[model samples]
Target: MPLRVSRTPTIRHYVMTAPTFFSVEYAINPWMDPTTPVDTHRALDQWDALRRTYKELGHTVELVEPVAGLPDMVYAANGGVLVNGKAVVARFAHPQRAAESDAYAEWMSRHGYPPVRTEHVNEGQGDFLAAGRILLGGHGFRTDIRAHREIARAVGMPVVSLRLVDPRFYHLDTALTVLDDSTVAYYPPAFDAPSCHRLREVFPDALEVADADAHVLGLNAVSDGYHVVLPAAATGFAAQLRAAGFRPVGVDLSELLKGGGSVKCCTLEVHS
Candidate 1:
């Protein structure tokens, strides 16, 4: 049976940063290997395709100017968590991505979303995801657990903390994605026992992905209630999404995947 669509498809607003300075120079996550070569042009093309996909889906796309040294800035989802016309800018744990906070904050402020910087190390939407009336926060890698409290206070929403145990799924967006207000798709092995239990309890009908799909960052997808944009390499996930009544649009982000990010990583949803 198909999963029930609880609400009409929402026209989302997304923010993206170009891959002009994209490269695999530093080894921050398990997916990044500095020894491998990166194709800047190909990365740009892939990102543009993703942007176009969002526009074609009737969603708005906003661009953030990319900085020369911050290659990971192209993963704009890490910039901040925007909700109700307010943004909680990321306080990146690594020095390499620390400067990106200011840029994102400035953009948010200029665009009418008041920005707040967190005292605890939080990687914004990278570790925080908005689902329904609450926020799902990930920790044990890039973001601190305490940041969840700060986020809850700032966004005025309840936050459920989920601990990520797998090094490869360092970010929540990489291991899991909210398909709609009441549904999600995730890899169980990526989270701890308690976190896994919490996920199952909260999202009983959530799609459980196989290891093959998880390896390809299949869960790093973006959805606007009806259409889901995911990695083209994750064919299995595409099939599962279709079975669940979602229109899956696959895009090749092979080049951007070289930097440990894909559709959801490159696109940050601005909830207002």
Candidate 2:
């Protein structure tokens, strides 16, 4: 199908952490198989390419220093959800990633975004996504359902809670991508029946990706109204994005995929 592009592109600010200490030393998600070898050098190279891609596309990219022992800190999107100058810091579900919240919160403070620490388990943007005026909160895995309300109070945005069912797509960003304020693309099976129904009702025009694309973490993407940056392997989703009036820029983060993250996993949008 011919591309049907229309929406005007918007310059966005994003936060990313270098994959300096990136390694799959332990299995936290289904995609993480520590026995599998990880090319740290390749991971760093790929992450740099992703950061460069954002800059080339006219977006501001900020860096958060990666701590020595926090290998998964490279997945910066899990750090927190930043919107309207407020930083709602994450309270990680796993002990391995808990310290990362402090590192990210420190960065936020230094950057002038006062952080609001949540009492409930919330894995930052991994479980919370801002969709238009409302915030989409995902639970049933990394984030507690109770955190949804806490986040809503922190950010002053109406929160919509969605329950995840598949462990493979543990985070909300893993199974769903907010293409624009009112549009989204997702894999319905990753969510519970009610959450799937809620998504349908809220975003009737949402693109439903095939299993092949979803498995490649295609739904994990970042969009600037018109341009959508996604995994290079998600050709099916790329085609869909073009058909739906958006430009798809593919980047290979295959090395970082060893730790179960791709483009969106590494990029955290800063709404300031």
All candidates: TM-score: 0.97, 0.98
For model 1, the stretches where C-alpha displacement exceeds 4 angstroms are 1-7
RMSD to the true structure for each prediction, in A, is: 1.3, 1.4
**Model 2 weakest lDDT span, ten residues long:** 1-10
Shift of residue 213 alpha carbon in model 1, Å:
0.4
* Residues 59-158 of candidate 2: C-alpha lDDT, one tens digit per residue: 9999998899999999999999899778988899889999999999999999999999988899999988888899999999889999899889888899
Compose the digit string of candidate 1's lDDT tens values, residues 132-243. Answer: 8899999999999999999899989999999999999999999999999889999999999999999999999899999999999999999988899999999999999888
* Model 2, global lDDT: 0.92
**After aligning candidate 1 to the native by TM-score, how far in Å is the CA of 57 from where it should be?**
0.6
